[model samples]
Target: MKTTLSTTFGLLMLSAAVMASATEMPVVKPLRGTVESVSNNTLTFTNRAGAQQTIGLTDKTGFVEVSKADIDSIKADSFVGSAAIPQADGSLKALEVTVFESSLKGSGEGHYGWQNADGSTGTMTNGTVGKLSKANGRTLTVNYKGGEKQLVVPDDVPIAYVEPGKKDALIKGAKIVAFPAGDGKNARGVAIGKDGFQPPM
Candidate 1:
C-alpha cells in the first residue's frame, strides 16, 4: 500500500517533525499514536507512551475510519470478533463486535482483555458466525480458530467498521494507527479509529 502522510493537521506536520526507534518487527506490527503533525505523504505522531515518530505513506496507502455499525447487520458464516463481558449464566455479552475482513481471519483469534466501557474486564474473541437467536436478547453463536462462544449482542453496544477517508480526516488529536509494511518508519495505514476507539485487533 502506498501512503503519503501530508504535512498539516491542527499543529501536526508530517514533514517537519520527529522520528524514533527504526527497529524491526513482525511483518505487520501495530503502530498507533496521536497526530502531532502531518505533511503530504508523511506524518509525525506521538504514541500512547508519549514517544513522537514519523511515518511515510504513498498513493496506495489505505485510509480507513472506524465508524459505528449495527448488530443486525451481522451475517451468518461471517468471520467476526468481539470484546465481550461474561454473564452470570456462563454467557458472554458483547461490548464491541467487529465483522472482520476475510484477509484478517485468524488474526487475534484468542480471548483477551476487553476493557469494557463499564469497567469490568471483558473477553475478546475472533470467530465465525454460527447462528443468531433473538429469544432472550440477540444471541449469536460465534466460532473461532479452536473453539466457539455464545455471545449476546446488545443493540447499544459499540461495533465498528473501517470506512474510506481522505487525509483531511487525519487531523491533529485524532487517534491513529499506521500499519507498517516492513520498514518500521514507512508504511501504509489500514485504518484510523475515531475518538480513540480501540482499533480492532
Candidate 2:
C-alpha cells in the first residue's frame, strides 16, 4: 500500500509540473516595434523590461507594435523595430518607431481649439486654412462648410488657422460660408456672417 501510494503521488507531481510549464509559455501575437537592430529575419527590440531581445519573424509571427491602424496599413520591405512600454493591460505599447517608408500624407481643417478624441487640443496655424471637421473618435472626419470628407492627419501635422469665434456660435443654426484655401483646392472653413443672425455661443 505504501509503494502504490508513492507511485500515485509521483504521477500527480508530474502532471502538475506539465500544467505549470504550459501556463508559463508566452502567447505570440502579431506585434510591431521599432527595430533596435536586424540581422536576416531576426529583429531586436527594447522590451518593456529595458532589455533588448531578438525575435524571429516567421510565418507564425504577427506584425509588430503599431497603434495607428493607418500606420499599420503601410507596407514595408524591411521590418523596423521600436521600444515597447507596458500598458495597463498586458499588451505592449510602442515608444518609438523606425519606418521604412513614408506613410500617406493628408490634411484637414476643423475647429482650431477643437478637442481631440484622445483628450488633446487641436492647434491651428496662422494664415493657413484647411477644411474643418469633427473628429469621429480617433477617425478624422472633417465637417467643412461645404461638405464632409475622411481625412488622415499625421501626428506632426500643423493647422494653419485658429479662429477667435466661440465654439457654440460657430455651429449655431447659421449659414456657413466655405471656400477653398486656394482657387483649386478643396480646403474650406465655416464662418457665420453678421447678417442679423446670432450664433448659439
Candidate 3:
C-alpha cells in the first residue's frame, strides 16, 4: 500500500509539471488580458478581472501581432469578425474589421446585434468568409455562427491582421487572446498584440 501511494503521488506531480510547462488548446476561447511575465517559453498574463494565467508556448504555437490592412486584403474562407452599422438598404457597413489568427479559426463564431456608440444599430459578427463584391465599395458575406450577413466593407474600413512577431512581444503590458486549453479551466495563448492594437477579444 505504501509503495502504491508513492507511485500515485509521483505521477500526480509529473502531470502537474507538464501542465505548468506547456498548455493545450481545446475549443479556442479568448485569453485576453495584461501580461505578468514570460519565462520558460511560457507566458503569464492576467485576465480583465485581474486573474493571472500562465500558458506555455510550443514551436507550433502561433505568436502574431496586429498590423494594418485594407478591406481588399480580406479573403474568402478567412476567419474574421467585424463591427458595422446598418445601412438604409439593410446592409451592414463595416466600421472595423479584424482577421483572426489561424489558432482562433472558430472561436466565438456567431452574430451579435450590438448598439453603436452614436445610438445607431451596430452588428458584431464573426465567422468564415463566404463571398465578396466590388459594387458599392465591397459587399461581403460571412457564413458561420448558424447565420449569415451581407456586409458592405468600405474601402476605408479599418482592418487589422495578426502578423508574425517576435516572441518577446508577449511582454508585460501586452494584450493577448489566449485560447482555452483542453482542461477548459486554464487558457493557452496563441496570438498577441502590442502597443494598444488589441484584437477584438
- The TM-score obtained by model 2 is 0.20
lDDT of 3 by residue, 125-146 (tens): 7678889768756778988756
Q: For each candidate, give its TM-score against the true structure.
A: 0.56, 0.20, 0.52
Worst 10 residues of 1 by lDDT: 7-16
Residue 36 of candidate 1: its Cα lDDT? 77
Using TM-score as the measure, name the better of candidate 1 and candidate 3.
Answer: 1
* Backbone clashes (count) for model 3: 1
Best by TM-score: 1
Instruction: Put down candidate 2 lDDT per residue, 151-185, tens digits, no spaces.
Output: 33333322111122321332222322221122212
Query: Of the candidates numbered 1 and 2, which has the greater lDDT value?
Result: 1
Off by over 4 Å in 2: 1-34, 69-201
- Please write out the lDDT profile of model 1 over residues 125-160, one tens digit for every residue: 666788877765468888865678889987777677
Name the lDDT of candidate 1: 0.60
Query: For residue 46, what is the lDDT in candidate 2?
Result: 48
Model 1 TM-score on a 0 to 1 scale: 0.56
